[model samples]
Target: MSTNNYPFQLGQDQSRRKFIYNFTKAAGVATLLTSPVISHADSFFVPPAPVTVGEVMDMFINQVPGAPFNSTVDTLKAGNRDIQVTGIVTTMFATIEVIRKSIALGANFIIAHEPTFYNHQDQTAWLANDEVYRYKADLLQQHNIAVWRNHDYIHSINPDGVRMGLLKQLGWQSYYNPVATNVLMLPTTSLSSLIDHLKQKLFIDKVRYIGDLKQNCQKILLMPGAAGGTRQIQAMGKEKPDVLICGEIQEWETAEYVRDAQAKGQKLSLIVLGHIASEEPGSEFMANWLKEKLPGMKITHLLSNNSLSFL
Candidate 1:
């Protein structure tokens, strides 16, 4: 892509803020190190070590506990984990455009909420000969950009990072379920009206649903990300929400299940929000959470827009 096609730039305030932040950070670190040294063996480990990509990754991983999906996919996707980060950019997916934007913002690290290699596991065997994949990989290598997928852990976190981000975006924190967060009780509205509201809020014009436009929907079950067929169906069955807001739906499974249920006169609705729009907000939220964790860094959020577009 041409530099002319680059979509964003570092604003003046951000530049000035970053400069002041670095100056203050230097002073604080100097003071900490110069203060009286502790004599205990544990305390003698020193203070204020430089941060690296691996350190950041470990910080995130430690936030979620127990049996979350742990795999190589969650590890660093590109560049060196040992490299000291200049800045971080959180996004839904690490597309070429987002990568370009990160480079322009002087961010050497990217924390993505989705896969970079077009698949869940990001296996490259099938993409070995693909020219498109090669070009993107080449760009990553050339820039020495580090990318880490924060999917499994983010979802597994106590408050669920994606839900927290989306709620903040939608301003639905007041309506959030106190007992079961997955279940939301909305004010009664027609199915079509709710769809319209989602369309405007999420910037999604179209949606696939399993209910009549005139159907009344109040209770909603929000299942973001590809939670798979079993989990989606099970949630709807257990909660019996009037509508189920999902990131994705399988044609023959969950969608069909909902369709058959609706045909049987069951009060159920299903709205597909697509994968990117559903989880991207959480990645945008990650930028803020990361800012709090590693302050004084030039952290910014670059939206990894949906890959496909409607005509």
Candidate 2:
């Protein structure tokens, strides 16, 4: 579904990322520990233990100990948490179309990458009088659908699940650095070629870049979200990638840093893939990852198109 369906109101979630060493181990234990016991036909009677939407999400995202982003923001946005999920839809955003689509597909659980409500934390106290909010909330209640945002936790997943998904989409599985999840080592290619590759593979319409098109780029620092200027610069300086591929950045912030770096002839380059384009794949990655993790439930990745366009 399009972002426009949610009207002009939008939320920007701040994901504080912490590196964990063993995500697979953590996630696996979480699944086994949190999983609802399966009923075997041979057994006399093993009643299916209720596995609610919140339970599954908590298992998946809480793989890391002591999550910095509290449950007040990560908790359920709509519907009851006790409602058993028939299936799950993991998307970049739970837009109006996605909510209806999930319900149509008989899926009651939606694990979204962004806020279901207009605010970053999905605070409904302020939107109590908003008709759009009422309609959306009422629709979710009518369908008995529950929404949960996987913003901070997913990014904080040991291997940085978000980056893992992008690597899978970009076909750079072997290029991932074990110690540093954000860095990438690739064969030398021009800036334009890399951009073209991103557009073709990621299906992006437009991208913003800083550096000459003909400039040769090899080492890539993939920062897929707006991690702010200081972090962005620190990463760039540390890795010193030929090109920095990122999701979103303020023009006055990291963008200006790259611009000034280029003036100094450091040959540093930058590409902004917009917030949705960069992190969207992570949610899609999450869908695939959930299949093995949540055996009883079918998980689908609902693609959210970039909310911006260029004339």
Candidate 3:
């Protein structure tokens, strides 16, 4: 073979022994086999690009339609946005236990679905002197963990990310109404059985409901998280669902409406799934989404369990 065809030039005068020794020692058999010249490779393996907290936030913002809203509660609650994220944890809330777990997992970014402080806007000025607030804040600061609320943006998605997740968990995709994502035309079943189904799927020991056990149910209106009493009632009125499954409800509001509607011989009902339990699946969905979007990055979903327990 002509030496010109080879990547390296070989001299005829060189002994076969000397040629083999030079090739093995200088080029190395392994290197020659793996090298781009001999292997005809386009590129070598490279690690996934290092991602920052802000970049991941931007990915969500960019994907969400009508994002960069005029005002949003989806703000970073702790740590610097510029910090390089070692790992990510998505949760319903950044509770003390969740924060500790994130730290233990070596995750520096926490994408939470609700307020970190006790209120909607996460106003810390009022909580400045509060002991619990101070402790939670200090813990995040100590471990350099960043908590970002993803409330508005996640809900702003067309089908609503939280609702999509909940529907997926319920195995009701076939029953979902695309035009009215919250509405589901389930196969006719008793209200009690529906509640049982929800409890089983949601892994909840019990659920608070306002309806007779034997009442037949077909239409369902699922409003996860605290969509407020007025919104829930209005949806109930408009959709005229046989049952309204929601996160949390004030005793004097939607629950009362359901009671009165039932009194009037209306086929109406309500099931409260608690706020944390209702939205935790959405956080899990978010983590799963990020796993696909940023392959090779560590993303985990941890539940921020409900504080209430039956006596």
> Where is the poorest 10-residue window by lDDT in model 3?
19-28
Indicate the residue-level lDDT of 157 in model 2.
Answer: 73
Q: Candidate 2: lDDT of 32?
A: 22
lDDT of each: 0.76, 0.76, 0.80
lDDT per residue as tens, model 1, 1-311: 11221112212123232111121121122222333576433322233346899888888887787743545468678887887887788888889998988888777899998788989888889999999999988998898899999888888887898998887655577888758989987767778777766655566768777777777777889988788999998888899899999999778899889989988889998999898878878986787787677656667777666678777
Poorest lDDT segment (10 consecutive residues) of candidate 1: 1-10
Badly placed stretches (over 4 Å) of model 1 are 1-50, 67-72
Superposed Cα RMSD, model 1: 9.6
Candidate 1 backbone collisions, by pair: none
lDDT of 3 by residue, 3-98 (tens): 122111223323333111111111112221256457564443344468889999999989889788889999999987798988888888899998
Q: Give the per-residue lDDT of model 2 (tens digit) for 181-292.
A: 8888777777877887776566677898999888877789998867877899899999898988988887898888888898888989998888888888888778878777
Q: Choose the strongest candidate by lDDT.
A: 3
For model 2, which pairs clash?
A: none
TM-score of each: 0.81, 0.81, 0.85
Worst 10 residues of 2 by lDDT: 18-27
Separate clash counts for every candidate: 0, 0, 0
Identify the runs in model 2 with alpha carbons over 4 angstroms from their true place.
1-50, 67-72
Q: What is the overall TM-score of model 2 with all chains considered together?
A: 0.81
